[model samples]
Target: MEDEAPVIYGLEFQARALAAQAGETDQIRFIVGTQSLRQENQVHHIDFDDENNVINKNVFMHREGEMWHISASTVDKSLLTTCYNKTSESKAEMRAALWRLPGDFDDVQSEDQSSHQSLSLVCHLDATDYGDMKSVMWHPTGDNSNVVGLADNHIVVWDIDTSGNSAQMTSSAGLESKGQPKLTCSSWDPHHNCVQIATANDTFIRGWDLRTMQQTYVIENAHGQLVRDVDFNPNKQYYIVSCGDDCKVKFWDIRNVGEPLKVLSDHSHWVWSVRYNRFHDQLVLSSSSDSRVILNNIVSLSSEPYGNLIENDEDDDDDADDRESREASPPQDGVIATYEEHEDSVYTVDWSTADPWVFASLSYDGRLVINRVPRAEKYKILL
Candidate 1:
């Protein structure tokens, strides 16, 4: 098979928020939000046809504010949450809310990209009493009944009633220390049926139990500087990954938080996002403020460490010229591949729920690139 070039799509305004459209297997889809202070912010529904290498999009006007972060429901395709920057009386405030697409977000041909339909308001995930909202997380595998939001100084949990189009604040926990400690990002613990969650508060990483809304575990100084993002290993129950301003991606076992299982100092600037491949946890991805995305194979610590391995090892007997070439820059398997299609800071990278081999990355300049696992790497895992 020939190598396919990445399908590129551009948005009107600068953006940093992106989410993979959930619960669909037949199509590759994602939602991207725009950030503009003077112009109306927009939410774009993007669809990629892998066979033909085409990108289709639908645009909707969001009159609220500049989007800070966005998340999609695993159950409802049209339902999503956005943490936005709303300015009132010359004061900028970050807020989060639940909104619904006008109709048929998956159907690209249903409406033209210039329809300019206003987003339907579902309900307000009001965290005003708490503080500025950072991000919202939905249950990975459960129904769309409960959602978690990271506010300035609190992890606010809410129960959504779609029938009434309203959300009720169920529980919230304060996270403050000597000085003001702001919550940066969060991840839902996929282990134990998603009962726990971890939040990056200041430079410390803390876990909380959803049932009691209390702290469960703490990894003090998990990163040398501020931690940007955290993600739970989907296949392994205890293993998790984190990246931060230290420009390093570290893996940890929450059970033993004293030290990290492994660390990779691959990015030159702040590592903004890290995600383990949904099906193959060994395949890891990390995007950085240095405007690069690195794909790594952390085999030894993966769920299937010994099985279907040795793809890179098979090439060890190559000629001396090949060895010299590899020393300068290696192949896609174990040597890792750095994607540099964006000119701005690449903030978010995600694996496609529909196709395990396909993934998407969004940069701050509103460049969305749809890429796939290297064919050699893909065949190595399957064969």
Candidate 2:
């Protein structure tokens, strides 16, 4: 049989948020960020075929407010929401509300009610407002009722009740810095009993223990410039990765806060986002200001024996040979593939939670590309 061709698609409005629904392989959703002369900001749902062709799409407009960040629940695939920071001459408030999915798939409707019934507000917050909200994320575990939002220099946690009718502030923590850098990103550690949260601020990557509400660790000078994104390895407890304005992607072991385990400098411009494949821990995806998306194999560096050297041979000559063996090995965290299909700066790249080989990238130029990692390269495993 002939090889299947790759599938590609583009959007007219910049995508501010791109999320692949959990347990879904053929459909993904995004929010249009930039308002155009002809088109207003809207939420879009798109479906693709096996060949990667766009098959279906649904678009809806949010007339009440503008959205800055969006997050979907993993436990309940039907729930997706956006956070808005409304600033005006009189007051500045931040709130999060659900996006009513078009059609009969609405989760809010009762069994006896029709889908056309008016949608109700899911969450409203007035006491814990921030100046400029940057990012928001739903907790990976639990019932997905908890959410964390990054604004200014503080991180605020909120718990949504089962009904989604009300949201309550659970806790808030301030970033430890002499001069507060804009909090750019935040992520939850996926491992069990890992109450750790990671945040990227300016040139630093800091970790916090939510259990005690204390700063657990800090890696200073994490990036040459402001760090734009950070993600923890879902399968590994102590591993994390970050990207920033320095145009470099760096990996770190959270247990050792001194230095990055590996630095993958492939992008020629600012790197905006880095995400690890939830299933394939060794694979990472990154998008850059150079208008390109790159996939990397992180298995090599992750397999290295760091701080756990076994000294079977006690002779000095044997020890020297062992050191040379370690030094001669080629660095593992290298760029495996690059996708330069975006016309503008690629802002976000998200891997499908259901399929390890399939991933998506969204750019500031309003292009969204769904791609599958090459089959030939997929079988290579680190021995």
lDDT of each: 0.87, 0.70
Candidate 2 global CA lDDT score: 0.70
CA lDDT, candidate 2, residue 105: 34
What is the C-alpha lDDT profile of model 1 across 142-213, one tens digit per residue? 544999999997999999987799999999998757676899999998878788999997678899999998
Q: Compared with the true structure, what per-residue lDDT tens digits does model 2 show for residues 1-383? A: 23245455566565656776653433444333333434445655555555444544445565445556666666655556666656567985655565445443333223333222332345553335555666677778654567777778888777877475677878888866788777888888877564779988889888888776788788999999989999988876788999999999998998898988899889999998899887777778999989989988776545334323334455646667677786566345567788877878888888766667778788776677878776655655422
TM-score of each: 0.92, 0.81
User: Highest TM-score, which number?
Assistant: 1
- Give the candidate number with the greatest lDDT: 1
The residue-level lDDT of candidate 1 at 252 comes to 96
Q: For candidate 1, report its TM-score.
A: 0.92
189: Cα error in model 2, Å: 0.4
Q: Which stretches of candidate 2 lie over 4 Å from their true place?
A: 1-4, 23-39, 85-95, 100-120, 125-128, 162-164, 302-333, 381-383
